[model samples]
Target: MSAAYVEHRPISSSKDTLTDHHVVIVNGASVGGEFSTQLAAKNYACKEGYHPVHVARERHLQNRDIPDHWRKDPC
Candidate 1:
């Protein structure tokens, strides 16, 4: 089974618009899974086991943030 893991870290000492970074982990690994929002990171990690399906659907919905390589087609 896979699970979502989140790590919080300050981006810098200065007061910035985006102060923190959220890294999403699953099965002790992270691959391009970083988000400005914790909810997005958690949602990314939660789809670990079903990445292809999620990517496909998200792509269909015109979610441009999703990487092209992660899509289900052309496999």
Candidate 2:
């Protein structure tokens, strides 16, 4: 059965604030999937054929910059 997983985390940071919050959604074998927002990721996770949707939040020190293209809406 197909499964959906969502991970929410921060991708970039400054001395004062955390930025570039990201939500990633994976359906089955695809690990590189990303969503613009948490709601969008949740919606995709709840779609038909995706079983046992899992949602998680992670906190970590920002490690890398987000690409400019990743900031655009995918829809």
Per candidate, the number of residue pairs that clash is 0, 0
- Every model's TM-score: 0.42, 0.44
**Candidate 2 lDDT (Cα, 0 to 1):** 0.47
lDDT of 2 by residue, 2-51 (tens): 55555555443444445344454444343435666666676665654455
Q: Which stretches of candidate 1 lie over 4 Å from their true place?
A: 10-19, 50-75
Q: Would you list the C-alpha lDDT of every candidate in the order shown? A: 0.43, 0.47
Give the clash total for candidate 1: 0
